[model samples]
Target chain A: MENFLQFNSVSYFYQTKDNEIQAVKDLTFSVNENQFASIVGPSGCGKTTILSLTAGLLTPSTGEILIGNEKVGKHDGKVGYMFQRDHLFEWRTIWQNITLGLEIQKKNKDPKKLARAEELLKKYDLYNFRNKKPRQLSGGMRQRVALIRTLMLEPQLLLLDEPFSALDFQTRLLVCDDVYDIIKREQKTALLVSHDISEALSMSDRIIVLSSRPACTKQVVDLSFEGKTPLLKREDKEFGRYFETIWRSLTNENQKTS
Target chain B: MAGILKPFGEVLPMKTKKQVNFSQAHKKYIKRLKQEKILVVFLQIFILALLLGLWELLAHFEVIDPFFFSSPSRVIKCIASLIAGGEIWMHMGISLAETVIGFIVATLLGAIIAILLWWSERARKVSQPYLVILNSLPKIALGPMIIFWVGSGFSATVVMCVLICIVITIISLLNAFTSCDQDKILLMQSMHASKFQILRKLILPNAIPEFVSVLKINVGMSWVGTVMGEYISSSAGLGYLINYGKSMLNLDLVMASIILLSILAGGMYFLVNLFEKRKQQ
Candidate 1:
């Protein structure tokens, strides 16, 4: 399959005032067009560093990354990032937050973009809260707003960095399903970096497991389940088997590091 | 044990009754809260009245010299006479204009300078110590020099007001702008937002609470600067009136001017507070 994004022997090192910390070691992976892929690993295992490199927020020390056959630059406007926190401006209402990117890009006056924002809010059941501040919404609702805000930009790839970790388990499940449904319905490719094995397994078409510091892909697991949505897929009879397999891979790497 | 249990027994029945008629009880609770609020306002007025009454009585009995310490009634009469003559309005109007102008200009200039400092780390580092030194210097000491530079007129008074207010506004706002959540800025950066866009969309909005706080502080500072400026050189204004009354030994006029100053400052503070409440909502 033709890759939408490719990491060609990408290695990254963060330089502090005193020492250079090797973050990623010759990492190589790719996500195909319109595919939902996840990078899962142990906590503080350079998952976010990989996302940062992919987003072109940081340059790789030794390798190159390509998006749609083009090299990623410092500010490409091609990658949309959803942080762990919603980071919605409290002063802005839902409508304002949704159009933050377009406003930054000065595309807010575009009628087509405005209509898309309105349609997304309406379709996602957040139309009623469009005029309300982000603090007024529940956790799940805020994440949905965050997703819609990202979607308004219509970037080729969505980079989510543990977007659901702040939520309670119950809300996390529901939001996972909602986000998965939205990504699928919009036909957008996504790269999620998460520590939750189940989250990665249920929401992703493929999972890229990374080792500890100086992370490189340890294993790539492709998952298929009879159920369509993430919540439904969580109940698949083989869900536990897949979970065991990913868990073993992560723990085996942890053991090697120790 | 029975004596303590008796009070508990009585409360239990009432609590159960309230639970049985929850809506009615809730309404009664709200009504009681409203009555309590009204009572508190009444008590505040009563305290003020009692204090004024005591001051009048003391002055009338010659316990305190009425000449040096004017009574509340005398102050009111003095204000009433000024109002009747229509002289108080000019002083009040000139002072109000100076204050409003100074407050707005200082706030805008200070916020812009703060944004500049936030944008350039080198500029901030270079100017920070100078700002600290300026903020610490007694601004009143600069009164004669400012009057000399700007001339002894309305502009001098406004210059004094701005001088007093601007440094603090810049410092506080810079602190707020620099301390905006780094993650949020990174999120904006990821979207290819320029520094100016981040300022408009993130930093400025994030600094609003601090901005409002600075406005509240500036309200008081601007008044002080204007009045101080008037003390140095002003042909008309409440500050000028106070200086005139003091020189002429008209304690009542001085008291009246001070009262008017407090009322105007209180009004400005109340407006800033209203802005804060609306922002919160």
Candidate 2:
């Protein structure tokens, strides 16, 4: 019930030499601790902008964004982001990629952190691949590796921006399950940005829908289902109703904008 | 006729060895062979045969002295003599030392400078244009000036090689570091990585392929700079041997020196290629 992250009337604009294009306007939201939250809406609805703002890479034009009761800027390390592309360095062995944060933080000497990294690789069945490069892995495996790389940092909240959009449908389903299990097992909270209504409905505790460009939060739904995993939940008889409701919310908003 | 069967069982490209149909496999082999060689092979064989035929023709006509033109056979004999006397090895050793030292120093200096420049956006903005301007200037024009400053010594030759090669290394690697997937950098930032941490873990590691490529380009450039420096001033080196051969009108010596230079360049090229292959693996 308590807020773990808050966006207080946040707005963003990109200023070029000629003009300023507003990306998001007066956006306000809060995510509770340990909640799996997702944002879904039309293309270019500032979904990615929201993630960037939350990560403190882009300063909000009008209002403040907070993480763990502190303004985002005051603490830069409390968030973890996974992108649309896994963006794993091709030259690094999988083990090296996962431990990159620790090495960079000079935490390689910390026995506990190093052990946790190894344990995660073993648990994920990527242990055998620890010596392989990112290119050597399949697309789904690379995404899992990317996720593990973020988890190694052990941040308070993980941000995924359409993380499985590039994957084939079959791989996407399996990866969605793998990702959810990892988040739960690690006891880490997450905020995912996706376009898949079914993905948002199935994987998230709450879905935040935004309006089109210069986006603002349009609706929020708290989802509950009678199944354990995303694939199982997709088979739930009520899945159609939930999908329809979210679909109408997105489509109706687009109609209003046009 | 194949249309009905087209969608059924296409093998993955990786499975090319085991699963094959004649038309597709034959076409693929043809495409690959065409890609691997065309102009380079033709030019190589043409150059070889033309030189030999020209030498034999000139000797037959006696239009110019064989001593000055130095028929291909005479050049080969001179090469054999140089190798037999061990003079070629000594001269080659001196040039190789200059080239290797200069190359290593240039690469390190360039990498350090690139890292420092990359760390500060303001520094990159200010210095990048000047570097471009410096690289644009012909390095050979500065050969004599370098000889004066370093007094036509070994260190001056090394400095010349470094001067020629450092710009390329810095430009290539700095580009590589900057071009690291922005998403990945953002990921690192969210993990609360420090600037130094990102450099050590993400940026530098990602830049390895590019850095290796830079070494490949610099191998030849540094050799050129070192040999040019030696030719302009040094008392010993393969370049000096060539310059002496030219003054004495000994065409066989000149040809021998050039063959020796090619071997040195080819050796360095092979070493760099090996490094690249290992990285790829």
Best of the candidates, lDDT: 1
Model 1 has a DockQ score of 0.24
- After superposition, which runs of candidate 2 have C-alpha atoms over 4 Å from their true positions? A68-71, B1-65, B80-90, B153-156
Error of 2 at A55 (Å): 2.4
lDDT of 1 at B46: 100
Q: Kindly list the per-residue Cα lDDT of model 2 for residues A1-258, writing each as its tens digit.
A: 478889889899989999998999999888888889999999888899899888888899999988888888834678888998898877678998888778777898999998999899887777877887777667777888999998888889899999999988877887888898889888778999998899988888888899998989888888888987887889998789888988999999878867
DockQ of each: 0.24, 0.29
Expressed as tens digits, the lDDT of each residue in B1-281 for candidate 1 is 23322311222111212345468878999999999999999999999999999999999998999999999989999999999999899999999999999999999999999999999999999998899999999999999898889899699999999999999999999999999888899889987899988988889989999999999999999999999999999999999999999999999999999999999999999999999999888
Say which candidate scores most in TM-score: 1
The digit string of per-residue lDDT tens for model 1 on A1-258 reads: 478899999999998999999999999999998999999999988999999999999999988999999999888788899999899999999999999989888899999999999999888888877898887777777898999998888889999999999987877887788889999999999999999899998999989999998899999888889989998888999899999999999999888878
Enumerate residue pairs that collide in model 1. none
C-alpha-based local distance difference test score of model 2: 0.85
Docking class of 1: acceptable
For each candidate, what is the lDDT?
Answer: 0.91, 0.85
Docking class of 2: acceptable
Lowest summed lDDT across 10 adjacent residues in model 2 chain B is found at B4-13
